[model samples]
Target chain A: MLKFDEQKVKENMEGALKLRPQINEVVDQIHERGFSNICWLGIGGTYASAMQAVVHMKEKTALETFYENAAVFLTTGNKRVTKDTLVVISSVTGSTEEVVDAVKKCNEIGATVFGFIDKAEAELATLVDHLISYPLNEQLKFFMVADRFMYLAGEFDEYDEFYNEMDQHFAQGIVEVEKAADKFGQEFALKHHQDEIHYFVGAGNQWGATYSYAMCYWEEQHWIKTKSIESHEFFHGMFEIVERDTPVTIYVTEDSQRALSERVVNFIPQICGNYTVIDAKDYDMPGISTKFRGALSPFIIHAVNNRIDVHIEKINCHPMEIRRYYRQLDY
Target chain B: MLKFDEQKVKENMEGALKLRPQINEVVDQIHERGFSNICWLGIGGTYASAMQAVVHMKEKTALETFYENAAVFLTTGNKRVTKDTLVVISSVTGSTEEVVDAVKKCNEIGATVFGFIDKAEAELATLVDHLISYPLNEQLKFFMVADRFMYLAGEFDEYDEFYNEMDQHFAQGIVEVEKAADKFGQEFALKHHQDEIHYFVGAGNQWGATYSYAMCYWEEQHWIKTKSIESHEFFHGMFEIVERDTPVTIYVTEDSQRALSERVVNFIPQICGNYTVIDAKDYDMPGISTKFRGALSPFIIHAVNNRIDVHIEKINCHPMEIRRYYRQLDY
Candidate 1:
């Protein structure tokens, strides 16, 4: 019956050094097992985390990482998992029924399961092969899922340089995110964001995070039209359809890619479209550079989800959380 | 130089045969070359085709297909291309400035080249390893960019009975698309769709087509918010966001998926979202089934670009033919 604390969560994230080895071991096990195919499954931020991990690891694992949407992982019936599969379950609560069902099937089909969960005793944890314990709960998000997850991976994977960079990035990113959030009022930007369709653009590893943190959540929560494209692809003819009114957002990951990011940011004003962009490099964080992984960029993107949600709520004239359980779950 | 006859265009679409083998063949070449890792470059529909083709073939080829936007592909100063690759040129007219530059550089890089062109003698025709010819200029879109290039693998590759089914699907598909287009402007649907934000959703192999078509051209051209998503994924959470003001169009692809399409259609009304859906199987052509190949489904989605633009104009009160531009080629 233990829950999460916004402050404690923050402390854990702000000081993720404690959980490093736990996370490292998990990433290592999965990496060593080398499941040619992987399905990262979960809900909300957990789902987003799975995406970030895949994005970071993608250059390494490529399409071997698949985000399994709970509703339709099954091709026919009862027979969903494949033998050459590694199922990674991510959930702050480890209570999502879909994740539970998915993991069970994966086990049935003889697939290995790897996950990071808050509680070792959670049902979803039972079906997993390597369950890395971490602090997740309602407060997990407030603690900043990005920093915590990144640190966990760093401690375990021993990417010393990357860890150090991520640490620097997080400490600084927190302040910048707060400042940006304050500037993100509805009339100023959210009004603009909510009313039109949006495209979330990023390049390399940052693209997947853009998909989850920007495209999927924004579209789902607000019923706003949000699509994502990576880098220069948006300019291919898509540039023509972009009018002065079109709102596009670019995810900036690091200094090296800043030029590429800036190139796109600079083009929007000229491309007959209006845009709001976030530069992760400029984001106040402790050591963000090392955290830049092909599969890991989503974590950076996740760091911004709430700020965006806050602004979206301002435009929506509603609270940021979805509270309805009126309709019973279909399954 | 051919102009369009609305009546004939509509009628001929009915008579058009499914070019699945041709489409699949083109995809196969893409797949084969893709196995070796090639950079894809193009402009306009060619770019769109390149994007869809690369995305479609990624599952089979892994990370080989790269969608290069015009600015980077054509105008780059030699950093992007190398000898260990191939370049696919897709332009109906084969004369766009960026398209030309992309092909020339690849030739300079000694990368194998492939072209899907409307005119055999088009400038890009001189730049490739293999050329797939089409009457794209007369057919409608000169850039065979989306239709042929996007579909090259599917169309030019070896024929399959399934491909025949796909052809029958396209012929019949045009009719159903027309029907969907006809319903687009109803006062009820218009209140939602025409209001500045448009969204489209489809799943499986069709994800690319739905995502690209709605997100790219539909959203792009109309100066509205548009989006596409995999169907089952939406239900995982987006369903609750549906409200009366929301308007949705679902692309129902094949016999196996018809019932699933209907279920979603039924849900749209129940959730109070304004919606219009089309079944590809409803097309005038008969016997073909809509099947998916990894990321390849977007090719079919690309084929419907004209109808999307046409319908946007028909509903938004724009003139019959919005002469945004007509490309007169130097070639």
Candidate 2:
């Protein structure tokens, strides 16, 4: 594997798994305290992750959950948000200005805020009422919280079974997915590294991943121009731009919305000669149940797509951390 | 004024305004019937338009409102939707496959549906419980329904006055906006017609206009590659790709979230010399009150941007109505 560190990957996954106990404890406390609804507030990548969680919540649980962009939420506050709202936020640096300001506003509104931050000393960690500092797999952490909340609410019956399965094989399963995906990722990176622009499409729970990877990784990290649309929306406005030689990538999920992406897959080949389909069902997850696959597909898809990011970074000779305007010079 | 028909636009705007009496009648009937919440379901351009309405509703009303992509809503139904839910939908042709299917599902759920369709004989017009068959200026129609609902609920006290003022100035105001914007639009089109791609940024009420114009107009209608990002999210990932020569257009709104776009305005000129700012505050609305500008900015901005579309259509020698794959091909 090119630039792959197997040990570090496993260690990071295991480390994220270790936070399950803390996550459970926090969720239990929040559940005991009672909340009118759940609000996930974030910006950019974090915002996209929160959107995936909210989509999952809509599918499995009847819990009132809202996903909001931190900055937009700050400007146009939701009437549903109140003292009884349980606000969940995440930040890798724990210092995204918008998320920090939003957390402050949530605090002023007397809402209980639980944040997933990478550093305990970060500003967001200090502001949040409850903070989880181990942030390796944010999607998994959010699922754990949502699953626990559902368990307490008598909505998710497979909570213990799900976590128990994850304990046994989650880390290794992700590694397997990455390994399976690396070959295709390298090939894709080699082929499309110099392409002017790419169109990415996904539906269901994978929409957030598709959106974030296209903008945050491909555009931000590699400076590649890209357009991402929901699979259902691909036929709307985006389809007109697809020519025979246009490069298109479709992330097909294993959820109920698989049909939506299948529609795209069936349609894209008819118009686009250069196209790729990354299907979640193509990968094998030995321990995770099919019933929970839809809920966990975002994480699976993320792990699988990480290979592409690494390969693209290597192919383009662009360090994933390089930025020209973001935090490099003051705006 | 190339390809511009001032008389046609005025007539269309006035024709749309004429539907207000029928719109008010339908909303009044729905008010009497009562609804638990309002749900706007649409796809692509209509979805973006509904999004703007939801954004406005958030700032002005305490009503429980939802904006959802029709296809996604069909796959993963929201728990908030119920028999008492008011589902608002709009379709120009009124036979969009996913929208038609979603309307059927909404009907199965027994939710009261109000639809805006251009043709009385359209499939959707026949399906919806209450249908308004005049579809010019959809944003205005959506706003009118929203305003009426809020008025009946005691959330909008100036609804009558607002409509009265719009009736007096809205049509001519839009014409004035188009006239004011033509020169700039022609200049912009002539300058950027040959550019490889464009990056559009907008915030608050103008985000939908920005998104729809970039995708539905630029990409779908004109086959031009473009990327649109919300102003707040631009700083997240899109900002990294922007250079001194990058062609960026920022839509600045007059809403509460104006600060979000202002932040981008304050930063873009320093980095990108080719950036253009389309501020909603620059246009004057003589008879309309400043209090309603935030709610009306989407319509105002849409009218202003029409000039750009008209000019670009003429410059590129590509008819906006021509599509290689939309309805011409069966996917």
Candidate 3:
């Protein structure tokens, strides 16, 4: 719990939930105006965090969704993004060079750009056709964007109703997250923070959170060696790295592909010396129904990971905010 | 060129080129039949190799293309797939369980599935609606598929004509590959094969090759630590991990984003001790036009990396073919 702020976490979650009405209003406008397809663009963690929602939208909705790295899109133009396409993009600073350039390119192509940003007056906001300013918590911002798309799809009413209940019990949910961290996250971090390399494995929506945590939290923030491998592709090539003493972190979601994660969970412990399993089912979302708990695994896993991040910072004696090159050096 | 096989590589290149007519015929059939969109399904190296083609299709074609991991696609269904959808898949051995399962799922969903395989009597070929059996070189198979999609898009006739010319000089091209490897690849592998971790940075289509070599070749084959990061995102987060002696292999292509790759090339060597910059412009493809050289960078780079693979194997005393778990153990 070192450096953890219970009040700040609660406020951040609450602030994001408080924007539900605005987000719904924006969704209404997008629906009214109409769009041929949806384009989600970002770089690094921004790109990684958007995967969960993209996967969900792809499964339950017929809407064609293009989730691309902002820079990659600039190199390989998306043929699907016509004037009728609606693009959802996010950058906390509103000044990520690749994303800003991507927004400019989108404008040139006459696509309708919708942005979610922390800075209302920043360059990205200026370039976007519509901007929804929000506080910077990647999980919350991605959730808001995904919620709007899911609402538009009209295929997840049950899950949406469950999300509303989570919103109602928002503070209680924060309390539960903190309690779960004490029992799970901090202990796991304390045990394995010094491992030479860590593998983060998960399936379904939680895979996105797993990827984001490996890149943004472990590698970017802590400079720790990490690799995020999806459970489905784990056997393909990456699983070769697994040795008897290899460190592995497994995220088990309640999503449709829970069995896939379960497969790895069963297999890894038998061979890999270290297995840190964070199962979303272990965390109690007081007012959230079991049916929808799986859908919210990405957020739940992210909150647990935040606690682990605090513990890792304390153990490594390195501030998570310190950076050797990111934003400090020009490339 | 420690383990280079000059005549074999020439034959391999010629064999792949010889299939161009067959590939064109298959593409003509697909064009005549018509499809609502394109879905590409593969896993591991197969999935990684398809990126260049997908990007090219996205850039020049109005046709919407979906590139997905075969296993991930099974768990999270692609809503865009229907009877009208043309799904293209590849597996060399025809026994990749996930791909076979994916083909079965596509059949159940009534989507038209076409496969590129090594054998017509193989499982994947049998499951697919149509099959183009070919050699195992990723560059050739992907080119066949992409050429078909680009031909359908009706914007890449010039590039296609250039490809035909290169195909005619296929044997001569292998010599170019060896010359480039002697000048570039072996020196790189010899210098930095002892490094703990390596970063592969590139932009445009080469990004896909970087990723494939990182995971499928280095990590999977050699069990070496590797991270393939896009040049644009390098500044965002992954750049923080770089140190004074960090080993970085940079790929500079002649594609539209050459400036982007140049940015990374100019910056990395100043901070990192080791800089293996493989610029495609250095390789000479005799019959290929200067304007079209950039488009051929992915193949040129792949061939160069193959030489580097030989040196890495020699240094580590680990044959690239040996695997501890991949296809050796059940997941």
RMSD values for the candidates in order, in angstroms, are 7.5, 1.6, 2.0
Order of the predicted models by DockQ, top scorer first = 2, 3, 1
Q: Between the candidate structures 1 and 3, which one is better when assessed by DockQ?
A: 3
- DockQ per model, Cα: 0.19, 0.75, 0.66
Question: Per-residue lDDT tens digits of candidate 2, residues A217-265?
Answer: 9889999988899998888887887889899999998887888999999
> After aligning candidate 2 to the native by TM-score, how far in Å is the CA of B250 from where it should be?
0.6
Instruction: Looking at model 3, give its docking quality level.
Output: medium
TM-score of chain A of each: 0.70, 0.97, 0.95
Best-to-worst ranking by TM-score: 2, 3, 1
True contacts kept of each: 0.17, 0.76, 0.74
Q: Report backbone clashes per prediction.
A: 69, 0, 0
Clashing pairs in 3: none
Off by over 4 Å in 3: none
Better of 2 and 3 by lDDT: 2
Candidate 3: tens digits of C-alpha lDDT, residues A1-331:
4666778878877887777787677777888888798877888878876677687566577778878788777776777788998888877889888899988999999998878888898967889987888776665665666667766678666656766786898556866777677756677877878877788899898887787788888888988877778887787777776788778888999887788888898888667877778888888888777777766777777778878888888888989998887777666
Angstrom error of the Cα, residue B184, model 2: value is 1.4
lDDT of 2: 0.87
Give per-residue lDDT, candidate 2, residue A5. 89
Best by DockQ: 2
lDDT of 1 at B284: 41
Docking class of 2: medium
lDDT of 2 by residue, B30-120 (tens): 8897778899999999999889898888887877887988988888888778899999999888889989999999999999999998888
